[model samples]
Target chain A: MALPVHASPLERIWHYAYLVICALIFVFLVAPILVVIPLSFNAEPYFTFTDKMLSLDPAGYSLRWYDSLLTFGMLAPDAPRDGAWYADMWRNAAWVKAAKNSIIVGFWATLLATVLGTLAALGLSRPDMPWRRAIMAILISPMIVPIIIIATGMFFFYSNPCSILGFECGRLTSTYTGIVLAHTILGIPFVIITVTATLVGFDQSLNRAAASLGASPRRTFFRITLPLILPGVISGALFAFVTSFDEVVAVLFLAGADQQTIPRQMWNGIREQISPAILAVATILVVISIGLLTTVELLRRRSERLRGMTPR
Target chain B: MADLTAAAPLTTADGRPLKEALARAQRRAKTRAFLLVAPLLLFVIVSFVIPIAQMLHRSVYHDGFSANAPAVSAWFAANPPGTPPDEAAFAALAEDFRAMKAAKTAGEAGTRVNYTLPESRSLFTKTARDADRLAPPYRDAFLAVDPKWADPEVWQAMRSSSSAYTSDFYLSATDFRHTADGGIERVEPRQRIYVYLYIKTFVLSGVITLLCLILAFPVAHLLATLPMAKANLLMILVLLPFWTSLLVRTTSWMVLLQGQGVVNETLLSLGLITDSGRLRLINNQTGTIIVMTHVLLPFMILPLYSVMRVIPPSYVRAARSLGASSWTAFRRVYLPLTLPGIGAGALLVFILAVGYYITPALVGGADGQLFSNMIQFHMSKSNWSLAAALSAMLLAGVLLLYWLYDRLIGIDNLKLG
Candidate 1:
C-alpha cells in the first residue's frame, strides 16, 4: 500500500524498506529454481559455478549434462543421432524409461481419478446429497495423510492382495497395477476438489430445463453440464496427472523395477550420486510444470468466465 | 391397517398420499445421489481405507509365538501368572523345542520373542537343537540346555506371547514392556528412540509452523494489500513453487546448500570464513529445516493470503484514526483478523511436516532423521508390526489436526493457488 502523506520521514523509509523486503522474498522463491538451470549447463562435474562462468566465458558452460542424460545408458554413445539411436536411448537409458513410465502411470491414474472423482463430486455437490460433509472428509483424507503412512499401508495391503478374499489372486506389490492403484488414491483428492469447486457454481435449473424439454439425464449431462464443466474436468485431470507424475513414495513401495517413474529414478540418483544428470531432469521438470501451471491458470480463468464470475 | 391409513392419508395432485409421495421422491433422490458416489466411495475404501485398517490391526495381531510354539503356548495358558515353571511346563517346552527343530521353524519363533527380549534369538535356536538330548526332571534339563529357561523374564514373555492377539507391538512402540509380574515397565533408556523421534517430530513441526507463519505473514499481507494485477503477477512466485515437483525443489536446495556449493562459495569469497570453516549446511538438520520451510511456505502463504484478502484494510485505518499507533492497530485489528488464517496455515504445515519423509531422507543426515525415517527403518527391517504401530500413532495425530482444520476452516476451503 502507498504510504499515507505524513510529516515524518521514518514512515516513508519504512514503506520503501517493506517493498525491498518483498523483493527479497520473491527472489528467495525464484532463485533456487533458476540456480539449477545454470548448474545443469556446467561443463565441469562440480555444482559450483566456475570462475570462467563468472567472467562471461562461454567455455565454462556446455550442454554435456543434458546430453549425458541421453547417452549415459545408451549402447553406443558415439553413434549418429539416427532413429535407431533414439530408439536404443529410449530402451536403455534409465531416465528415458522412467519418463516413459511416468507418462504411462500419470495418464492411467489421471483417467481413473478424473472419472471417479468427477462423478463423486457431482453427487457431493448436489443439494440433496446425503452425508455430504463426512463423505467429503473421507474422500479428501488421502491428501492430508502422510505419504509414508500410505506407502507403508499399501505395502502391507498389496503384499497380500488376495488374503482378504481367502483366495490366491496373487500379489499387487511391485506390479504396474499396484503402483497405478496407489497413485490413483493419492490423485483423487485433487480431482474431487477441483471438479467439486466447479460444480459449486453450476446451476441445477439448467438440468431441470433440459429435462423439461424431454432430454435424457445422460443427454442433458453431455449437452448442458459436461461442456460447461469441461475446463474444470481438464484442470482436475492435470492435477491428478501431476500428482501421479511427481509421486515417488508410492513407486518406491508399490512398483518394481518394471514400473520405475522419473521421481523414483531421481530419488536413487540423489541418494547414490548427486550427478548433473539429475539437475538436467530437475530443469526439465521445472519447465514441464511451468507449462502445466499456465494451462491450469488459463483453464481456471476460462471457467470463471463461463460461470460469469468476473470481478465485481 | 394399510387400507385404513391410505384412505385418511394426505393426498397429492397425482392421487397418491402427499406424505408417501414426498417420502418416495426423497428416497429416490438419496439413492440416486448415493449411486453416483458409490463407485468412488468403494474405490477409496478398497484402495485407501481398508489398507490402513489392516495395517493398524498389526499392532495387536502378533501371533508368532502362539502360532508356532504351540506346546509352550499351551503350558503358559495352563499355568497362572507368576507360576514357577515346574516339570510339566518344562516337558511342554522340550516338546515344543523338538517340534520347532524338526520343522526348522526355531529361527522364526526366536525372532518373534527377540522382538521384546534382546539377545534371546540364539537362545531359542541353541536350546531347540539340544532339547532332544536333554534328560527328564525337565526343569533342570532345560536349565542345563539354556539358563534363560529358568529366568522369570523368559516365562513372562512366554505367558504374554501365549495369546495370538497381544499389545506387545504397541508396548514396544511406546518403549514400554510387560514385566514378569504382569506390570508395565519402561524399557532400557538406550533403546527408547521411537518416543524421542515422536517428540522431535512434534517439536520440529511446531518450529517449522511458527517459522512459516512468521515468514508468510508479511508476504501474504503484501499480496492482500496490493492491486489485483500486481498481486496476480506476484502470485506466480508462490504458485510456481507449489506446482514444481517436490524432488526438483529439494534437489535445487541440495545443489545450492552443499558444501563447496554456491552458498559456501559465495560466503568464502566474501571473506566470511576460511576455506576450512565453510558451514556444513547439507545432509543435516539445518538443511532439512531450510528446505522443508521453503517447500511448505506456499501452503502457509496461500491460506493466509486467502484469509487476509477478505479482511478490510479500513479496520486497521479505523483503529489508527482512534489514536492507536501503527503497531497497536496492526496488533489489535489486523493481527486478530488473521488468526484464522494462521491457524489454518500453521496446522496444515505442521501436519505435513510431522509426516515428512523424502526431504529428511535426502538432506537429513543420520542426526537429522525424523519420525518417518524411523518408521521407514522399521518397514525395511520387515518389522511391519512396529511400523504399523508407529504409523497408527502418526495417523492419529494427523487425523486429529485434520479434523480440527475441517472444523475450523472446512475442507471445502482448501485451495491450491
Candidate 2:
C-alpha cells in the first residue's frame, strides 16, 4: 500500500512541532552522557573549560587525567601534599577495591542468574504449569520489595548463627558470598522477566517436532530450543550483569571493606571526596554500557528473526 | 482434558492405578519445580522475611526495665506502706543491678530501659554504677536521684517488661505515643521527623515520574515510528543507560553538572554569565531531579516504545483521512492506544523512584533527602525494628498507590508490549 500523506498546513505545523519537541527531548536525554566524552579530553583539572578560555588551544587537550587513571590506580602514588584532584581519588583504596569487586561480582552473579533464570522460565512456561500467574508474581516479589528491607534482613540472617541445611549457618556478613548472593537474588527477576518475554514468542512446536523425530528432550533443548533462545538468554544475562554491576544499597549493608562494589566505591568517593578519576571511570562505564546495550539490541533482533516474529 | 488423560499411561511402573501414577508424577513435577525455585524461596524467606519479622517483633519487644527491676515492679504493684519497706526493694534491686553490672552486658535490661526512656543510655550507666554501693534505703536514694522514677508509669513499664514487647519505636517514628506516664502524647515536636521525609519522598517520586513521562514520550514516539534501521539505532541508544551501573550514570551527571563540570565550563566559555553564574547543578534539588530523570528515563521509554511499536499507523491515518488534523488524529486515536504503555511506564518509574536511595543520597543535598535515606540510616544504626517499620511503610505506600492506579486506570490492560 502507498503511504498516505495528508500534509495540510496545520498538519505540517503540528509535524514540525512534534519533531522539534522530540529532538529537544533526545538532546536532553543524551546531553549528560555526551558532555562526558569531551570533558574526558579537557586539559584542565576542573570539570569545566581549560585556561585556553575562548581560544582553542592545543594545550587544552592534554591526556594527563586519563594517563593517571590508567597507571596511578585509584590511589595516590605519593602522600597528600597539595589537594590535587587526581591525588585525592588515588588516596581512596576502597574505591579501587569496590570497582574491582563490582566487576567480579557482576560477572559471576550474571552468569548464575542467567542460567538458572532461563531454565526456570522454560519450566514455568510449560503448558501444564499450574498457578503460573501467582508463581510469576511470587518470583517477581524480590524486585518489588524495598531493598532496605532485604538488606536489613540479609544483615541479620547472614550474621551469627547462619543457617545451612537446617543447621546453624556460618557468619556470611561482610563477605563476598553474601554480596554475590544478594546481587544474584536481585538479578534473577530481570533474567526471568526478559527471558519470559522472549519465550512468549517462542514456537514450542519446534521443540515438539524435534522430540517426535526421535530426539531426546535434552538433545532437543540443546540443539533446537537452545539455539533459538540463545539471543534472549544472552540479552537477559547482559541485563542481569548490569543490574548486579549497578546495585548499591543492598551492597552497602551486605558488603564490608573487602567486598565493596564499584557503585559503593563511587558513593564513598562522592560523599568523601570529589576527583577527576571518578569522571574517567564514569566515562569508561558509559562506553561499556553503550556497547553492552548495542549487543542486547543485536541479540533481540536475532531472536525476533529466529522466531519469525519480526523482520530483521 | 479427559481424552488427554486417557491417552497417558493409567498405571505406575509397578502397575498401580492411573490416578496413583498421575498423582505420583504430579508430585514429582511439584518436587522438581520446588527444587528449582527453592534457593530463591529460601533466600527470600531468610533474607527478606525473617529479619523483617525480627524487626517487627523488636518494635514491641521490651525486656530491659521490668527484668532489671523485678523488685521495683513488685513493690510498686504492692504499693506497700512507707515506700514498700525500702530495704527489701533496695536489696533485691541492688542484687539485680550488680548482676547486670558484672555481666557488663546491657542484655534485656538495657533494651527494657531504652524502650521506655528515649535517653536511657546515661540512665542505665548511672544506675549500673550505683548498684554496688547500695546500702540500706536504696529505693529512696534511687527515687531521690530521679523523681520521675517514682511515677506509676515508670513502675508499669518495669512490670510490662516481663514480656519482651512495646510499640514505642514505631510510635516514636510516627511521632505519636501512649507513654509509660499513662498519657497520650505526641513525640516531642523537636524530635519528630521522618513523616515529612515520607511525604517529600512521594512528592519527589511524583515529580520524577512526571518529568520522565514528559521527556520520554516524544523520544518513544520518534523511536516507535522511525525507519526500522534508525529506530533500532535510537532504541539501543535509549536503552544504553540501562546497561550501565546506576552509580556510573549518576556520577557521570555529577561530573557534568558539578560547578567545575563540563556544563559550567561550556557556559563559562560561551560568556553566558560571570564566573559566579556557573550553574549550581550538583548537590541540590535540581541536581537530584536532573540525575534521577536521566537514570529513570530509559524505563519510561522502553515500555512506552514497546507498546507504541505494536499500534498500527492506520488508525491515526484513518482519523486524518476523516478530516481530523494531525494533532487531533494523534490525540484522538494514537494517545488512547498508547495510554496503557504510559501507565505501565509511569508505574514502573514511580515505584522504582520511590525506593531510590543511591542517586538522591549522592546528588541530593540536605533539603533533597528522601525517606529511604532515613531508612538507610536506621538500618546502618542497627535499629532493625525501626528500619523494618520504615520499609513496611514504604511497601504499604507502593501497594496503595499501585492499587489506586489499578482502580483508576485498570492495570491489567496496561501493556508494555
What lDDT does the true structure give each of the candidates? 0.89, 0.72
Q: For each model in turn, which proportion of the native inter-chain contacts is also found? A: 0.75, 0.45
Worst 10 residues of 2 chain B by lDDT: B408-417
Root-mean-square deviation per candidate = 2.7, 5.2
Error of 2 at A184 (Å): 0.7
lDDT agreement of model 1 with the native: 0.89
TM-scores for all predictions: 0.96, 0.86
Looking at chain B only, the TM-scores across the models are 0.94, 0.82
Instruction: Report the lDDT tens digits of candidate 2 across residue range B4-31.
Output: 8778766667888878778888978776
**lDDT (tens digit, per residue) of candidate 1 on A164-264:** 78777789998888988999999999999899889889988999999999999999999999999999999989999999999999899888878889999
Q: CA shift at B142, candidate 1, in angstroms?
A: 2.8
> What fraction of the true interface contacts does model 1 reproduce?
0.75
Best by DockQ: 1
Count of residue pairs whose backbone atoms collide, per candidate: 0, 15
Report the CA-based lDDT of candidate 2 relative to the real structure: 0.72
Clashing pairs in 1: none
